[model samples]
Target: MTAVVEKIHRGRKFDQVLQGARTVFLRDGYERASVDDIAREAGVSKATLYAYFPDKRLLFLEIALTECTRQTEQAAAEVEDDRPAREVLLEAAQKIAEFKLSDFGLQMYRIAVSEAEKFPQIGRAFYETGPQAGCGLLCNYLRQAVDRGELVIEDLDLAANQFVELCKAGLFNERLLGVDRKTTAKAIEKTAKAAVEMFMARYGAKVDA
Candidate 1:
């Protein structure tokens, strides 16, 4: 078994190689994907692909899960910090739900799980980017909301994780288990709204009588 490389060796053909691997991984998944196939798709020589990735696992991580962190990172970028907690939290929840419920997101997760037992790093990296980073983002926004007196929460960490879970509750579970495979604009909005309402009900600062 090969050790997972945390850092990618980025060269001139880096994006080209990753683009190829992305296509193959999304299509063939981790276990069945072939380096030769990826190299062919990339239009690079086998030697060149090996020069950049060294092994299939490294390439898989780069294309499948590592860069997903880069993609999922904009969850809070457009959301203003001063916005009402309900609005900000709703936006954040929607972002989480959209990504987690997306086809790409689902693929990213499946690849991580399929490879996790053999490569623990895959699981850690997935959780770090998926749940941990998401929770951190929510914590930042929730802290701002608290500072603004929009919500009253004693445990910021718990609240952040709870909100993330709320976003994933129904449809995410269904889709992950293959019980329900479709996600729509309507479902995303509904999940986000419900998560925000529950969060606000639990934490929204009350007015004095």
Candidate 2:
């Protein structure tokens, strides 16, 4: 039997391994983390850990990719509605803001930022899985708006990127800081509302939504 097959049949708890790996990676950062540390954290033998992930990089990469895919899918699904394009996009941004506050989201963004300069591959994969996918989902909705003459965008792709960038510029920074301040939920709502309004003003024809 193949190594991969054996690993699968070994009754390995890959999900638990990933959870422990995520904790180790987040606590130690990518460069400082090690296979032994991850193995110990996961309560698995080194052999078992290696049977699944070849190295720390691959393990962290898988974690980031999984999170990115999950968040993107959830974000896309949350914004799915017959509401106006502006409203839908704003709702998506709000959902993204909420996600940014989650432990997994913060860790993923931190990993990407810390390694992006030295390890472009990690950054690229994170972008492809997260922002790029989110933009694609948003572009699909924007294209529909264009069809109805709701936006004067000559390029739906660029518009989608711009919209995401606009929303992220605020939420991403706040999240990177962990937003630990004891701000009220009302303040968060205000911030999200303003971000959406500003974003809509730039590209929206009818901003009432």
Highest TM-score scorer: 1
Residue-wise C-alpha lDDT for candidate 1, range 26-116, written one tens digit per residue: 7886677898899999999998998888788667666655555665566656768766767777877887888889776887777678888
Task: Report the poorest 10 consecutive residues by lDDT, candidate 1.
Answer: 1-10
Per-candidate alpha-carbon RMSD to the true structure: 3.2, 5.2
> Per-residue CA lDDT of candidate 2, range 1-209, in tens?
11111223224577778888988977886767888888899999988887777666567767878777887777666765467766776677666666665555676677677878887767887888887887888888888777776666778888777766655565566656756533345555666677778766776675464
Computed on alpha carbons, the lDDT of every model, listed in order, comes to 0.78, 0.70
Worst 10 residues of 2 by lDDT: 1-10
Q: Which stretches of candidate 2 lie over 4 Å from their true place?
A: 1-13, 23-43, 54-57, 169-171, 174-184, 206-209
